[model samples]
Target: MRVLVAGATGVVGRALLPLLTSVGHEVTALSRTPRQGTVVADALDRSALHRAVREAAPDAVVHLLTAIPAEVNPRRLARDFALTNRLRTEGTRNLYEAARDAGATKVVAQGLAYAYDPEGEGPATEDAPLWRRPPRQFAPVLAALRELEERTTDAGGTVLRLGHLYGPGSSYAADGSFVRQVRAGKVPLVGGGGSVFSFTHAHDAATAVVAALDKPHTGPLNIVDDTPVPLRDWLPELARMLDAPAPKAAPAVLARMAVGGWGVAFMSKLRGADNARARLSLDWRPRYPVWREGFAAELNGTSDGTQG
Candidate 1:
């Protein structure tokens, strides 16, 4: 199979590209900055992206491009959310249009599994309602995800709703660009830190993306690990793995004042997602089932040697 991976330099994309190639697939990687074999394509530009897709003439296209800055900088996420929304909405639309025009058979793209409201059950399934009415600040992100999902899957494309990514290159690591501040004791946990979320290794997520290419299923699917960890538990465990001190707790009010609305929701809210559908449909399971084992491996820098 010939595959074209957008955002090929991204955390998941970087991992997925080599995985697909190792499996003997002809891979054409697309990114803004071209590498040895990568093509330069701006996903937001319809004509350019269309031409690139046409040139590659791939059997499948994996839309992994995201405007969200790496997780190390969660403090900046409020300002960046709008850009991410644009990437999810307009960028996704452009990718889907190009894929359809290029006669691609499969389109696999990334979605977030953590965006749903924490009002409902603990482990939300694909059928559960999204927090359509997010806080005024997050309204745009929720809107973009809704638009992206509708547009991608409308043409029989596949949507992989991934968990909070935490492996190398993601925001969850002590050395990750976004979350390093947390390790430096700059970012604090809000409220009681009771929010629960599912997570996946970047390589594990990439593997699922590759597996989905040949699967005969479509529509929304949760590509999460088997377990969801609560923030109260995760923060300490991650600190231990990174050899850093446990995050200091902040009063919810103080946190909201510091990081605004989205930070409060993320740090103190409760939400989890179920990936049973993906397991049944894709015939794939996550190498890392939860944050403890997988994050420990990542902190120990073992993920590089175990790409599969």
Candidate 2:
């Protein structure tokens, strides 16, 4: 199959290019700066996106645009994610429209598994309602996610609701801000830290995308590791792996003040996702079935912190 990937320079996109090539698929990466045989387009710019897609004439289009902050500070993180929200909402529309015009039948886009309703027990399944009334300010984030998924499915595309990505080139990477902050004892354990989080190795995530490529999917599918652990369990282990001080505990009052309402809610309410659907539908399993191995490999320098 011929695939056109926007955001080719992003964490997952960088890894996906080679993955598709290795599988004998012809892949074209859309970049701001065009190179030999690559498509050039900014995903936010609808006209350019459509033109590039039309020119590439791919059978499938992959949307991987993101604008996460370089620094991990709360202010910067909030500001940067707003940009990502736009990418998920507006940027997604552009991709879908472009893909349709380009005669592409399948559009594979990224979504987050952590956005599901926090009320559910264990890992949230694909059918679980996303936080419709998220903690005040968090509504837009989840709303954007829903919009992206709806747009993708409306176009007869597949949405991969990936878990929190780790491994190399991600927030958990050696040089990533999360590691730097944790080493500095800046990230705190909030309100007992019971909130669960699913994780995915970036390499495994790219492989999942490949698996979904040929599969017939029209709705959201969770792509996560086998284990879904809580912050209390993973947080301290991550700190230990970094050889850093354990995260300080914060009471509800202080936690809300420190990271704001949404931050507190994220650490206290966000639930993990169940990947049963992805495993069955995509015929795939994570390379790192547990985040422990993946995190340890990246932190301990076993994984080169490249790829995704």
Candidate 3:
């Protein structure tokens, strides 16, 4: 299969390029700054993107761009949410249109698993309701996700809702970002820290994307690990792995004030997701099912130090 991957240098995209190649697929990586053979195109700029896709004439097109790096900064994080919202909405629209014009048969793109409502089921399935807290503020993001999924489904494409990403190139750094901040006693565990959250190693995420391409699954599939831990457990576990002091508990009132409503809620509520669909449909299983087994490896700059 000939595949055109936009944002091919991104976290997942970087890892995905190799997987697609390893399987004997001819891959064309698209980037804004074209490499030797990359097609220069911006997701926001429809004309350039259309031209690139038309030129590549790939059988499949993957949308993988997101405004990252701001995944930690408070202000920038909000901006990233808005920016990525556009990427999911406008970027997806552009890619789908371009892919259609290019005669691509399949389209696969990234979505989020943590967006599901954290209160309902013990482990929510793909059909669960999305997060509705601060409903007005997150309206655009939810709408965009819906639009992206709807379009993808309509085009016979697949949507993979990935969990909170960790490991290399993720915002949670080996020596900086959330991991470091918690280690240095800068971040306090919010609201007794009992929220259930899921995570995925970047490499696992990449592999899942590749698997979905080969499979015929459609609709949203959760690309998360089997283990979903509470903030209370994962935080201290991460601290221990990094040889840092455990986190101190912060008052829920204070935490809500500090990190805003959504942050506090996410840290203190349950948001687990089920991965049975992906596992069954795409023959995908996470290499690192839990953080304890792989946290140290990620800090050491490898995905479990056993990728073959």
Candidate 4:
């Protein structure tokens, strides 16, 4: 297969590019910055992106562009997400156009699993309705996701709804801001710490993206791990592994005051995703099946070298 990968320098993209080539697929990587063998173009520029993909004439295109800032002011996620929301909505359209112009038959676009409504229980499947009615703050993100999903599916492509991304180059990484905050006892366990999350290591997520390219689909597929753990469970364990100070519990009111309402919602209400569809259809499973063990492996800088 001949493939075109946008955002080739991103966390998952970095991993996916090599994985694609190792599997014997001809890969055309796109990056804003010039690199050997990578097509240079602004992913949001429809004309430039189209020209790049057309020249490559790829059979598939993977859209992985995101503009999340390095330094996160938790109080400002709504503000911080503005650019990334545009990337998701506008950039996705541009990439889809590029793929279409290039005559690519398969497209695997990036999506979020945590955008589902938090009212229900258990892990959310692709059928769950996204948080459409909102305080308007989170509406942009949800709207972008909805647009991206619909556009990809309408174009006869697949959407990969990924879990909270971890592993290297992410905020949850060993030397990341979140780890530092935990070590300094800055991140508090809000209320009962009830929010559930399914995590994805960058490598595993990359593997899933590659798997999605191989599988034919026109719907959203959750690409998450087997275990769905709550914040209260993982935070303490992560602290323990980092030898960091244990997080202090904050009442709902106080936690909201500390991290803002959105942060609190993330800690106390967000639900996890179920990856059964990806598992069966893609014939793939996470390399790190559970995050508890995965955290140690990532933090300790060790790998079992298996795409578990």
Candidate 5:
């Protein structure tokens, strides 16, 4: 397969390139800035993206474009995700059209698994409705996600709705911003930490993209691990792994004052995702099936953290 990966330098994208090659696929990286083997073109730039896609002449195109910041403030969540929202909305449209024009047979794009409405009982399935009345800052983010998924699936493509990504180069990394906050006792467990989280290692996420390329599955597939843990469970465990002070508990009302409504919802109301459909459809399984083992390996330096 001749594959072109947009946002090739990103955390998951970096992990994906080498995996695709190991499985005997010709990979072309598309980036905004010039890299040795990458075709330079901003995803938001429609004309440039079309020209780049045409030049690559890929059989498949993977849309992993994002502009996420390293240190995200929950108070400014929407502002932080503004560019990423555009990538998911406008960028997806450009990529879909470009892929069609370039004669690509497959299109695989990234999505979020934790965007489901918080009123559910168990882990959210692929069909669960997105947050109907999200926090003011988060509403636009969900709108963009809906747009991305609809556009990709309407084009007969696959959307990998990944979970809270944790590994090298991700927010949960040892040196990452989230970890830094945890270490400084800045992140608190809010309202008994009831929100459940489903995690996906960057490497596992990359492999799922490879599987999507080889499989016949389309539409959204939750690419998460076997275990779904509540914030109270994972936060303390992550603190132990980092040798940091355990996160302190805070009332939801007070937390809202500090981290904003989005932060409180993130720590108290978010739902985890189920990966069963992805497992069956793509015949895929996560190497680190739970966050405990994955976090240990990543922080202990047993797992390779280098970007391609």
Candidate 6:
């Protein structure tokens, strides 16, 4: 199979190219900037993307475009995710349309697993409703995600709803912003930290994309790990791993003032996602089934932090 991968320089994309090749698939990288043999085009730019996709003439298309900032401000969550939101919404539409026009048989695009409503339950399944009424700063982000998923599914594509990514080139890396904040004791447990978190390594995410191409699955699939841990459980351990002070507890009201309503909800009200459908449908399993091993390997220098 010939595959065209957008966001080819991203964390997951960097890892995906090699894996696709290893499995006997020829891959073409689509990028905004010039590279050795990459199809140079920005996903947001429809004409350029159409030309690039037509030129690649792939059998499958993988949309992994995102522009999340390294240092995100919780108080300004929407502002931080503005460009990424566009990538999910407008960028997704352009890519899917282009893929169809180019005669791509399969499309695999990215989605979020942790964006489910916080109403109830253990871990959210793929069918669970997204947050209908979220914090002010998070509304647009959710709207964009919904649009991405709807558009991809309309094109008969698969949407891999990945969990909180934490690996090399991710925000949770040893040298990442999250780690820096944890080291400085800036990340706190808000409202007892009841919210659950499902994590995914960048490599695992890349492999899932490969599986999506081979499988007959369409619509949204939750691609996450086995364990769904809470902030109260993971935060302290992460701090210890970094040899940093334990995270302190903050009252919900105070945290709301400090990081805004979205931050509070993220820490205390967010729900984790279940990956049973993905496991059964794709015959896929996360290499690092739990956050503990993956985190330790990445932070302790045992791993180079690349998805590969």
The candidate that achieves the highest lDDT relative to the unseen native structure: 5
Count clashing residue pairs per candidate: 7, 0, 0, 2, 0, 0
Deviating ranges (above 4 Å) for candidate 6: 305-308
Q: Report the lDDT tens digits of candidate 1 across residue range 9-101.
A: 777887888889899999998877767777778888889989888888888988887766554233456467777777787888888788888
Across 1-308, the per-residue lDDT of candidate 5 in tens digits comes to 99999988888998899999988999999988887778878888999999999999999999999999998888999999999999999999998899999999999999999999999889999989889999998999999999999999898999999999988898888788888889998888999999999999999999899999998887999999999999999999888877889899999998989899999999999999999999999999998899899899888877763332
- What TM-score does structure 3 among the candidates reach? 0.94
Better of 2 and 6 by lDDT: 6
Query: lDDT by residue for model 3 over 49-140, one digit each (tens)?
Result: 89988999999988887776534544234554787788888988998999999999999988888888766858789989887663344556
lDDT value, candidate 3, whole model: 0.79
lDDT of 6 at 228: 95
lDDT of 2 by residue, 113-196 (tens): 998888888899998988867776676667778888899888888888989887667778898888998999988888899889
Off by over 4 Å in 5: 305-308
TM-score each candidate.
Answer: 0.94, 0.95, 0.94, 0.95, 0.98, 0.97
Which residue pairs in candidate 3 collide?
none
Winner of 3 and 5 under TM-score: 5
Q: State each model's CA lDDT, in order.
A: 0.80, 0.84, 0.79, 0.83, 0.91, 0.90
Which residue pairs of candidate 5 clash? none
lDDT of 2: 0.84
Residue 153 displacement (Å), model 4: 0.8
Shift of residue 260 alpha carbon in model 2, Å:
0.4
Could you give candidate 4's per-residue lDDT for residues 138-239 as a string of tens digits? 667678788888888898888888898887777887877788889888878897899899898888888988888878777898988899999999999888
Q: Higher-lDDT candidate among 1 and 2?
A: 2
